[model samples]
Target: QPFTYTTAPVPALTSLTPTSGPTTGGTTVTLTGTGLATVGAVRFGATPAASFTVVSDTHITAVAPAGTGTVQVTVTTPGGTSNGISYTYSAAPTLSGVTPNQGPTSGGNTVTLTGTNLTGTTAVTFGATPATSFTVLSPTQITAVVPAGSAGPVTITVTAPGGTSALPSAYFYVSPPVLTGVAPPSGPLSGGNTVTLTGVHLIEATAVRFGTTAASGFTVVSDTQITAVVPVGAAGLADVTVNTAGGTSNPVSYTYLPAPVVTTLIPSQGPVSGGITFTLTGTNLAQTTTVLVGGTPAGFTVVSDSHIVVDALPGAPGTVNVTVTTPGGTSAPKTYTRVGSPGI
Candidate 1:
């Protein structure tokens, strides 16, 4: 009697592991059904798969071929070809740019990412760390909160079911600015004085503030220096700070002195010969730069914020005005009399 031969059962595809993938297609898909061990080939629509491997009688792992739009996936075996299943090819997500591409190393700031095919984003990353949070606003844009990172540049990547893409350029991480000192730390309450700020990581400063008031203007001179014009502020100490892309700097002290006001002259009258020393009393006189007696410039010493000593200069024998000047500005004038010589 001749041995009887049994034929293999026809292959049947019940489902596809992943129903969609990138159009550039390299997606590994699992086809599950019966009689898969004898499967000889797999295809996406009319195009054959990049590769395929028979895992068992119930599973076949296949690499989908590069294609576009929706396509039917099928398996072929010695017995017969399986029924087609649906698979979709999508365009990979791309990153064109990121708004405010630089931020503090400590992160937590929101940034906008612009691109194409960004909808359905599964993840966003700065370097290797995932974003603190993110939201898909449209097919071309996404907003994400940055995660903490080391100082310097890092790649920003976006991932979707279709594929992952990185920005063409790098995003930057900046260290927060530091405040060490302020030159000419004291200014008049009326402001307008230019002061130098010294510190580290001070480049790209966007704002300079005294207490709650913003500086009138500022210039970044280097990574460690800046020049800013003080804005009008109340008398006494104000906290000065600098702001950059990295973050706000530590505060430094700034003093605002009220304008000087001359209230008295110890010797109101002096000889026209101009050889008299006199005490001048006033408020905000500590920084007195000059003294004028009878409209003539006179030598002077700042004894304190309320006192200054002056060496009277020769002037016409008559009553004239005496004034003092300081960083707080010229003082109000007081009367000074120069006596004439007495004849015998």
Candidate 2:
């Protein structure tokens, strides 16, 4: 009897992954199915793949030949040619927009990536840093977490099996405006003083606030500085903040110093006696540094922002001007009349 030899079974190609790549080709596709061990050749439509390696009876890695559009990919072994699966030649990716282009330096905000040919996006990056994570929602959208970064402008991009998006696609990593301190942190309650704010990431500040009052004529001096005309606020510690597209900064305190205003002087016509205690009534007198009766500095005590007590100073007088001074500056004087003693 003569011995009979049986040929190997024909291969059956079930899938090709990643199913798509750039038209320039050079994509390595994993071909999976039965009887792949002896894959002698791989064909994308009628064109042969540049190269192919059989990895197992059910796997082959084939380097795609340069091509365009979609085509059927197949494998052939000694047994026979396998069934065909589709492979797409994709166009270069394009970016349309990026949501919330600005985020914190620590980078944790969920940003939406919008563009064309974004399906199968393998990576999203800010500058050279990859996103924390990302999910492809469709051919035109992906959701990604911004990666940690230093402050200021950075370009953001997306990458797919096809290609990476291009630059000027704006992205910013900001350190929300910091208010380390303000020059001249205390100002007159009536405002109108130029104050310099010092900190980081102060570029393009949209608004400056002193407590609840908005600053006027505010200028962003640089990435870390701003100059603003202070706004009137109640006499107290006011919280100052800067706002930008990135975010609002932590507040720094500014104290509004109320200017003293003299309203009355008890015994406005006191005798020239140098030891008489005089009660002073005024607005914002608490910080009274001096009480002057006709150019004489008298001993004084501040009772409150609106009251003070001072001992009169001896003065040669018909009528003398009395005034009070505080950190906010001096008050207008009230007249004190002195009567000369009757001559003997």
The Cα error of candidate 2 at residue 154, in Å, is: 4.5
Model 2 clash tally? Answer: 2
Q: Give the lowest summed-lDDT range of ten residues in model 2.
A: 267-276
- For residues 176-202, write the lDDT of model 2, one tens digit per residue: 778899987776877888999999878
- lDDT by candidate, in order shown: 0.90, 0.85
Candidate 1 clashes: the total is 0
Find the candidate with the highest TM-score and give its number.
Answer: 1
lDDT for model 2: 0.85
Question: Candidate 1's residue-wise lDDT over 181-281, tens digit each?
Answer: 99887879899999999999998798999998999999999999999999999989999999888999999999988889988898999899888888988
Those runs of model 2 whose alpha carbons end farther than 4 Å from true positions after fitting are 1-8, 95-103, 109-115, 133-144, 152-155, 166-172, 187-194, 200-203, 222-225, 232-235, 244-247, 256-264, 270-283, 289-335, 338-344
| The 10-residue segment with the lowest total lDDT in model 1 | 287-296
Query: In model 1, where do residues sit more than 4 Å from their true spots?
Result: 1-15, 33-35, 76-83, 295-297, 314-316
TM-score of each: 0.85, 0.75
In candidate 2, position 113 carries an lDDT of 79
Count of clashing residue pairs in every prediction: 0, 2
Error of 1 at 166 (Å): 2.9
